[model samples]
Target: MNSVIDLLMNHRSIRKFKPEPLAPEQKKAILGAAQMASTSSNVQAYSIISVTDPLLKKELAEFAGNQAYVEQCGLFLVFCADLSRLRNVTENCGEIFHQNTESFLVASLDAALAAQNAAIAAESLGLGICYIGGIRNVPHKVSEALRLPELVYPVFGMCIGVPDQEPSLRPRLPMQAVVHENAYDTGAVLEGIQEYDETTRRYYRERTGGQTDLSWSRSMADKYRLPVRPHIKPFVESKGFKLD
Candidate 1:
């Protein structure tokens, strides 16, 4: 087994996948690893829907910003932040069922922890995985496709399979910028981001065959310049999360 640092440092998101299926044992082991992750108060307030149906996968692919990897990967799992189970139990026991801000945080954390463990497990087993954050583009459609009830929100999707291409390892920010001693320093943080922008621009030039001269900071600033991308406030509010 590789050391934790090696496994983490060597991580790369695999977008190209081969047409191969994981063995039953492999699937079980990956799921088991996810199940072993720490949960808030042992509530285990998350659920994973292993998508196998081709039709459903196609729909999910469209829902996730037209990411074809959803249909190409051998296993596409949707991680959900779920409070429905607890709510049901509470109601069944003749109690008031109220899910507030704290409950949402616990569910979200539980889902994120489990998904990370599953990603590591898949990587260890010689399988490639990529996280599909595009699921949030149309969260309600995703919930509908998966038949998720109220109080259960789709966190993200993971596509796991044998990789067809080995992409370069993406660069990361320097540790000095992120690791603070006792207090937070805003000036250091901004400087780190500026340095990282240059690094990312170099990486983009190398990877995309000089297609873009885009720097990370410029790209992010441009994104925020549009109102549509920032329109997620209403969508998230509709899902019952109060960012306040």
Candidate 2:
């Protein structure tokens, strides 16, 4: 109901950007906000790598499915779930390092929280932002390109810059589908899905000038009918994460 809520409601992925870099102060503010995000038990197990080199950004863009915005954005940040720092600290403190699935999840969630804060701070400064999850498609290649060490893996990337194009805000599922009162409501969820399908169908059609008529359910089915990113497990394990 306020400026914060208004900003949150208008959130959208910006794929096009103006060819201008952020000011030093703007970058500092955004990163400062990210560092303040909540962490699990003070284990701020995350690291951000700002890709400033043109060649490195180009390589990362390739690793992230050739997404041009990754190279075009004024600031490209690679958020990593970094347990290496924590492990080192623990070892130095004479405590045996112990990690499992729970620790891995905590680190990933920590990175995500920090990234969201950065996105909001950037948007508040009249900057457009987009999250590039496509980096996960070739996580190993991205890690190698970034020279990430063990216990540190790229969670995702973010593109931040001035907007060159305005895109429509994508519709989300109804509140009833996501929020439940006191307990899980299966019927409400199914109803919400059914309702969202119609909204998504109309969204794609209007967005594409009636050339596309796909529903959310159908698109999700197409995406999941095939095993999506089967290599993620092996890749994460290769990074020294103990999923068990």
Candidate 3:
């Protein structure tokens, strides 16, 4: 309805980008917006790494499953959920730092919120952005490369640059399926799944020029059929996080 809404609705991941770097003021504004994202109890338990070194970007590109966009993008940022800073502050004050699954979840959510804000701000600046969850594929390596300390982990990475391509907006599930009125409605969700499956099937066909045609449900099933990132729990624990 409004310009902001239109901008939000039109968001799509950018896989290709121009070689130009962002303006200094543009980077500042995006980061300022991210820092203002809502945090849990003002904990502000997140950190961001701006990877500008060409060698480092190349390494991270490999770490992110060899995604060339990670290296090609003008700027690549790693958003981290960091409890280490809070622990240092608390213990330095002679108080025992309390940490558990709740704290972990809060930190992760904080990182996500800040990242979304950064994305919006970048988009508003006419910069295209894409989230790279593949950083988690080799979390420990990424941490070591970035010199992350204990109680800090990379939540995800982001690539930002001038857009070199215009991609079609991907469709989302019907609102009725995702939004329940006063309670959870199973029937509505199932109906939504059925409808979305067909929509996605057609989407894949058209996008791939009929080379691929798979329902959303089938794709999800295939994905979940195998274990995904089984190393995550162990890696997080190794970083001194107590999942208990």
Candidate 4:
């Protein structure tokens, strides 16, 4: 495989980190790479907030479901889906900025794309990184803590630092389950998942030293079994996103 494919394939979420800070140049390079990522309609509707204050990091760690890495890592970054800039720009041009579901989707997608590029860049630099989706667990509190303004919402956070541990790469679903030709094949999809479930079960068992007995489907079911972040809709609406 090519270097890019190899880098992508060997990716792992790093939770533990060394207590060292990234060099100033390294941070610049990574963030610069993030800015180089493709944006929707050249809007670049996103912003990255680096959290360095000890008290703020501690509070954010609590806000993000007590994920210690949020505070312990060398750097913690909050990626925001930002439409505030665009709103100001349009209003200054004497045009009403339409805040609709499509606009929100575009901003969110742009933020995600930029964050993925940053993640890949960090991995290439031999730094470990983990995404903290738990930032959404208490979205309102997080927004207040970060002082996020209207038309901007925290998408997720990332922890980057020197690796303290090496974990095995997690297994993904079989390709047949995800990819399709011109027409979709229901039978192939079902069969592929059934086969892939066993693979994931084995991976989970081995990874957790048999403490967890789970498969891909089972994990997904448990995750969706409850309403996760039911406050997200109201939170987004409060952020000036007309998600209707």
Ranking by lDDT: 2, 3, 4, 1
Tell how far residue 37 is off in model 3, in angstroms. Answer: 0.4
Cα lDDT of model 3 by residue, 166-219, tens digit:
999998998889999999999999999999999999999999999999998999
Worst 10-residue stretch by lDDT in candidate 2?
56-65
TM-score of structure candidate 4: 0.97
Reference-based TM-score, model 3: 0.99
Model 1 agreement with the true structure over 1-244: per-residue lDDT tens digits:
5687788888999998998878889889999999999998899999999998989999999998899999999899999988889878888999987766788889989999999999999998889999998988888888889988777788899999999989999988766579888998888888998899999999999999999777878988897887754545566557665555
TM-score of each: 0.91, 0.99, 0.99, 0.97
CA lDDT, candidate 3, residue 87:
100
User: What local lDDT does model 3 show for residue 54?
Assistant: 87
Q: Which candidate, 1 or 3, would have the higher TM-score against the true structure?
A: 3
Name the candidate, 3 or 4, with the larger TM-score value.
3
lDDT of 1 at 11: 92
For candidate 4, the per-residue lDDT at 67 reads 96
Best by lDDT: 2
